[model samples]
Target chain A: MTTDALALPMAVPAAGLPARVRIHEVGARDGLQNEKATVPTEVKAEFVRRLADAGLTTIEATSFVRPEWVPQLADAERLYPLVAGLPVALPVLVPNERGLDRALRLGARRVAVFASATESFAKANLNRTVDEALAMFEPVVARAKAEGVHVRGYLSMCFGDPWEGPVPLPRVVRVCRALLDQGCDELSLGDTIGVATPGHVTALLAALEEAGVPVSALGVHFHDTYGQALANTLAALQHGVTTVDASAGGLGGCPYAKSATGNLATEDLVWMLRGLGIDTGVDLGRLVATSVWMAERLGRPSPSRTVRALAPTVASPASHKEQ
Target chain B: MTTDALALPMAVPAAGLPARVRIHEVGARDGLQNEKATVPTEVKAEFVRRLADAGLTTIEATSFVRPEWVPQLADAERLYPLVAGLPVALPVLVPNERGLDRALRLGARRVAVFASATESFAKANLNRTVDEALAMFEPVVARAKAEGVHVRGYLSMCFGDPWEGPVPLPRVVRVCRALLDQGCDELSLGDTIGVATPGHVTALLAALEEAGVPVSALGVHFHDTYGQALANTLAALQHGVTTVDASAGGLGGCPYAKSATGNLATEDLVWMLRGLGIDTGVDLGRLVATSVWMAERLGRPSPSRTVRALAPTVASPASHKEQ
Candidate 1:
């Protein structure tokens, strides 16, 4: 890449923003889970190691869901242990008691349970009602906490749902309270459909605060289906949310969502945070190189605008080494 | 498209934002200027008409520069008369007195002069020093004002320059003041290389305000090269600036910049504005259709994330009719 394209933005810190942001990297698990092809277990482990090398403190390693459910991430058993010895946090996804048992058996220290804020998504994604799904996650979270493991509750469809149009604020707040009450150490609100705007983001954070959920305990996971992810992220930062979930190379779309777009790209998030003078502890050059390498492994160009812009020479598969 | 994918974000107005935003549509001028393939004059005229039909009040029609400098927009004279009778305001770009004369000959009521904020960009883009370029625009702005015509001054490279790195705020403010002092009706601050962040945007606007420029007299023109345009636009909105410059369907790239990404997509901007309950009088569905049609003419998909998500089926050439 030319020096012009690789040059970082000038740092100018804004008011009412945190000095540091903890980026919850989700590329290895949430990103790979939606891929059609089966990535090798060794490749997944290297990807996590590369992410940790790029200075991301928390990287979601793999999902312990049943192999048939998300075959792309079926190698969780082999993947977690490979990256478990890293200095960074390796959080894995656990669907229920069975998944929790499998994860705990592998000596996993950090785990996240996925929940849905809307009824339609809960039924469509989990084949259960919202309450039933929460009932399933309650034990998983409680057990993890009892084991002194950090628990994260991922509340999906918090902004808009595909089957149900605009999700109500109270509906999302109730689910968030349920997750926190069941002992989730933190919560990641998911905009699965990516229909959220800045005002909706601000309003949701405010409502959650009014409902007794601390802003410090909340992280936002916004998809870029409508190109509102970074803008919504800025609103969350303005509201004192220091944790943001992003995927490397903008990988992983929601299989159930109508749009095929995925989570906010970590490279894009890092560019903004670095420009805002917020400490992310990320080496942008190294992070971009990692995404470029992963994009080659996927045999497709990255969906991230930042990745495409910063690493134009190596972004496409035909340009360099083949998978 | 499914209704779920076409769903609009819920209206949740935020505090400290303007009640309405006036979008300065530049697909025909700034957007088309960098095209390698020549779009037919008839297609350009129809694109402006479609943008007006989508409820954009101010549309920049074409630039009246020498044909050799920008062969893509060489049909400015032919394209201007075709869309001049529309109800919306059609502003054309003029690089100098000669270009301004050509525009005035066509009874143009609104014209814009493109200026550079940094010395390096001024030399590279205008072939003159910053002061020399300002001196050139002074006469052009005066002539337009004497004719009772509205003039917009575009200050490019206000945030970062390719050769100069991050531009100082005072340097940008000085150029903005110069443009206003020369009797320009409004100024559009251009992040030509798209390196701006929220804090930088806020800082630049505040600096301009300190230099006696009213927020009402300014517009923000952000590029999405680094995926920060919408966030920077949000910061501009939060600062109470109501005018935003966007390209229809995310057409146009800066041929001078290293990255090939273009302006912030109008559909993306409208999505955020509509969600914030700020009136821009745009119909999102119709706008997406217009962009899709223009993308077909360009023989490429639009760079806009919103256009891709909203009008997925029609954004590609193979799916529908051939140009």
Candidate 2:
């Protein structure tokens, strides 16, 4: 990208400053986990390799959750070893010490912890309250730190909860701080149901900054259920957050969350960032193409409007016709 | 709307400030024009009434174009007189002197002339080149002015043309200037294909201002084709343009522009504006309900994501059921 293209002429506000955003592709883990059919282990690993080959530095490999709870990702244990040390840090979703232990044994060096800011989401999703879930992660965080494994904390339902109404900003800030204090290197604030607007993101981020939280240590996960993900990410980027979690081709929606749609597509996010001259270092065309390929494997077209409109050749007409 | 809420604390450079923003609700005209099934004139009048009731003070109530071009709005002549002296000013879309004469005969005090920024879109859509189309509108605008009718000019394909990649900014500015000099009360820049971004909106508005076009006389018409409509609208709002063009439930798309989604939804725009504390005088629930009612008439769901997600008792179970 040209320096001239990146430079914003005249003085703009600091809160509105364009960010150099990096998208962490999470299709294999967070995306496919909610799929109706169980994706094969090789297919998951191949998806990871394709994302890695497309210049993605971080590809969430798989979740180590129990098979009974999430049958879709039951092959996590079998998939990890095959993708070890493939020029990218494969972060696996781990619920507790046991999951982390299993991931560590598979040669994993990065792990992500899942928690919810709302009590109802935590109970429905993990069968625990917010405090109970956090307590379970305390030991896992220490163990990961001792093993030299980086930890990332995902705080879901940070904006609005289905059972309850608008989530309090203070609660989100408190959970985020607790996760950071527990030794997680980065905290991703998730709008799991996609109810957030740019103003909500701005207010939440501003509240975080006001509470003395370092904005640079933040990441964002957004759902496109309400079609506000990309705009919300722009708001997050303006607040200086670097890492963003996205699903390839906008894959993945919370099956349990009736109002949920897909996560923000990596291609759409990359396209927006590139237009703003933000260096994401990912190949747009290749990333879009990979989503097209994944769409074929799942027997569906890619959910991302950008991928569908921009790259229509990932799967043959016959393959699409099979569905 | 509180003063504090409207303060866009997000940083934006001074040079990036957009010249102006205008909103034109096309629910009655362009939105209803493309419906395959005939919409009752009473329904169209009530639709316009509900839109104006929700603080949409400027509405495109009907079109005087040839019935062959748009049979859905063929009742424009009868509909115009029935809805006269509404709380808001009604703008009727006129294609040529004949349509302008029809509108004037029906007591239309405000009329809009449609032209394109590209030769290809102009020829394909209006059956004339850019210059020839403007020439057609020149006499119409003069006749409308003689009849004391306020004339608005619509410049389609302002950002990127479908046949021509990345429309030159100068070409856009020239069309805009010509419309202004030809006595257009305001100019609506249209991303008819929905391929524009916030950067493109900002650049185009800036270029227009640099070309000495009055910012207050500028409005925006965007399609959600790429899901950038709201963000692009925000960029325009930040530039101080107050008038924006939206369809109830994002209701319209150019039939010639294949794959183009609906226009920015009136419900979604009102939602975002309300969240930003921008007083649009639009009622979210009423706007959503009206669109949902209209969608049923069309045998489809409303295209607005906000309406789909936020409105209760409006979605058909089969609306999103995968084929």
Candidate 3:
């Protein structure tokens, strides 16, 4: 580039950065669901409580899917009552009519449905085609909306699919629009295989707008499998995405994606947002503590860099970004 | 942000991304220096050869500091003449006039000098004050320049110092200008503790330009301690930087910065740059293979995410971005 071009204002100006961002904590549901060990119901309860206490206003408490499908989260029925009283919007994942029935019976105030932007992922994850899966979620979202329950829609493999190398932009936009059209309040675009770069993110967000989806109604869920999650998040934020989905402690990647690793860690995201002078409301120190405690239950150290840098044994803790 | 704001172009337009980036491979020098085990002279020679074969044109071969200071690169004289015939720039680190004398006797074509942005880091790292260290290097740079050898200057802890919280911008800018004014061809700003985010990088680059330092003479060396390396690199590239410093397989972090982990992996950088259509002329497959091979020699798996996802054990390598 010419020296003159470098002097021009950067495309991602500080003014384009979001002032306040809402983090949707998905560790309780998405993170624990992928773990080999069945996290104790009390442990799950405490995780949600800690997440809410750490200032995560939208905490996905549990998934109401069947025990046969994901046995790890089979205790959702017992876990829901534990965190239902917290001063947070606890959204539980509801897969079908059966999952929605379970949530409605438990007086779930908020629920989320997962849709696939790729055909193979829909078949492998939902045992149905993409259209059939969306058709199945329509009534669940409509009924939940009728009962005064808010709904969120997650479109998996938005950027790249495990089966399809790169999901077409129109495929993601179609699924996102269908979810929002069917009464879902917000849609999160997921890069299931974690193959997205910033350019793909910006272009996809632009295409979603071209499809008539409002920017405020869209959030981004990126996996750190390729180390692009935070960078992609910055790109999305630059393009006006105010809501972001993060797993506390970099908890979960899609179990169905097989090769995908952890989600973007909330601590890592909070660190960047704080440095950018954006408000995330969540306390970073408290968030790292929560992840460290959860990692102990799994008998492993947290994979989060922020958590690693701030852990008790880390010297010069006073100089760390968290401190 | 409003829906209308989303319609606006992203801050980093695709056209603004760099078309070609130079990869300054630092694995042989910086990577092995931090390693606990001493690599043999022959192994270091083979490593440099493989890096050049993988299309890295500028590979930092070794450090010419006192043997007692860094025993890892103690065979600099033997190692230099070994790969001196390769089609690459082998720039060894010359700490002072004594080191410059050693390089001059050995017919070194390119050399680099180190400076510190903070006084605490200077004393801690170089056992000298910032000005003292610069004064010590001015002669080395002048001697190297007199011999028609290209010199590159490195300013460490430019963003955040472990002892000092955040190094002031002017402090970094002043050191940077001093280095460039002393006849160094390029200045590589080093985030020794790696706490910088994209916003800080943007502001610093802008500040440097305002202080009359052209972006053409700048390169960036970021550590992945906080997982912001790739994001910060994107911000730098958007600001028109065509040169980046990365270690193969994410090899090294400062041994002094207890919290810092791996250097930004060249494979990871290539993955993102390739996705953004930026060319760095490095064969990522060969690079990952080289890293995996080096990891075997070091008796550990690489810390790079791209390497982990593209390793032989990974199930779905076909859909991987690296492949």
Candidate 4:
């Protein structure tokens, strides 16, 4: 690479932000799940390894959903053991007790459960009411805690819902409180449709804090549908959120939402974090290279502005291959 | 368009931000100047008219640089007359006294002179030393002000430069003060390389404030090359900047910098501003339609994430044409 190709942002620290941020990389699981084509099991394994090698400490490996439900992640049983020995944290998604049981049998130490703040998504995604979905997750969280596995609860539609217009702050707070009450270690507040603005993010964080949920246990998962993810992430960081969920190369869109875009790109987030003088322990060049490779494999360019700008030659051509 | 295609962000106001912002639209001038294909004069005129109809108060029409220098906008004389009847502020760029004379002859009321923060960009872009470029702009600003015309000074490379790395705060302050001292009414700080982060944005704004430059007279022009523009714009807004410069469809990339990307998309900026309950008087649907129309003329998909997510059916197919 030329010196120009590897140009990094100059460090200039902002006040009222954490000194270091922990990025929960979700490309292998949340990202690939939404792809039209199912990737091979080994490619998924190698993707996780590359993310870890790029200095990401927490990588969500794959979902333990029933193979028929989400066929893309059906190889969870086969995929978990391939990278179980990596030094980084690999959190797999577990839909219920069955999913958790399958994950634990493969020696997975970290797991996440998906929940919804809106009732419509709960019914559609889980085939159960919001309360019933929580009840289904009750035993999964308990069992994961009992086995000393770290658990993360993903609360979707925290900002807006398609069927329901704007979700009330109190309604979202209730779901977040319930997840915490169920012994989940961390909560990732998701903007499933990417309709969130900075003020909305700050308001939600404040509401959660008032409900006695500490900022330390909260992470933000934003999509870029309206191009508000990075701005919203900035608001969350200023509100003391240190754990950010991002997908390498901005990999996936919400499978349920019609207008949803991909998750906040990891490389985009890293560029901002590095510029703020916040240490993410990520090597951006390696991360961009990895995203380029993944985009080539996916036969489409990464939907990441940072990835495209940094690796223009490789990224621009991938779009041609899509034709 | 279906109601789903017209999905708008729910308004939630943030604390300490201006109630309304003035968007200085630059797609006609700064945006198209970098395009390899020369957009027809009538098409450029229509883009401006559509922007005005969409509630943009200020639209940059075109530059008055030597025709040979910017062949894409070589028909500036023919273009200005076509859009001059629009009831909006059309600020055209004037490089020096000669360019200023041409704009004045065309009855241009508002004109902007380009200045650079670093010595390298000063030499590369203007082919003059930093002071020499300022010397050339001094007469143009005085002449325009003396004729009761509005003058804006564009200071490029405010954050970082390609030839020289991170630009120092004092150097930027010096050039800004020079432009203001030369009778320029407003200053647009350009992050030409898109390497700026929020802290750096806040720091620069604070420094400019300390140098007796009010936030009211300052505008921010950010590129999304590194995906930092919106986050940085949020920082500037928090620091009380009320004017922002954006292209209609994330239209232009820096011709001087190899790794640069387009300016922040006006649609992306409007999405965040509207979501924050900050009014720009812009109709998002009309704006998206306008960008979509322009992107078709350019024969490329807009770099704006909001445009792609909202107009997926129209935008996704444009890539096939590239092949």
Winning candidate number (DockQ): 1
Candidate 4, residue A80: how far the Cα is off, in Å: 0.6
Per-model DockQ against the true two-chain complex: 0.62, 0.22, 0.25, 0.49
Q: Give the clashing residue pairs of candidate 3, or none.
A: A11-B11, A12-B11
Query: Once superposed on the true structure, which residue ranges of model 1 sit more than 4 Å away at CA?
Result: A1-6, A312-323, B1-6, B313-323
lDDT of 1 by residue, A1-323 (tens): 13354368889999999999999999998898888888999989888888998899999999898989999988888888888899999889999999999999999999999999988888888999999999999889888999999999999999888878889999999999999999999999999888999999999999999999999999999999889999999999999999999999899888886574878999999999999999999988778878888888899988888888888543444543432
In order, candidate lDDTs are 0.90, 0.78, 0.83, 0.90
- lDDT value, candidate 2, whole model: 0.78
Q: If ranked by DockQ, best first, what sequence of candidates would result? A: 1, 4, 3, 2
Residue A203 of model 3 has an lDDT of 90
For every candidate structure, what is the RMSD over all alpha carbons to the true structure, in angstroms? Answer: 2.4, 6.1, 6.9, 3.8
When 1 and 4 are scored with DockQ, the better candidate is 1
Model 1: iRMSD? 2.4
Chain B of candidate 4 versus the native chain B: what TM-score? 0.95
Question: What TM-score quantifies how close candidate 1 is to the native fold?
Answer: 0.97
> Per-residue CA lDDT of candidate 3, range B12-78, in tens?
2365877789989999998889887889899889889889988999999999999989988889989
Looking at candidate 4, what is the lDDT of residue B135? 95
Candidate 3 structure, TM-score to reference: 0.93
Per-residue lDDT for A26 in model 3? Answer: 84
The residue pairs in collision within model 1 are none
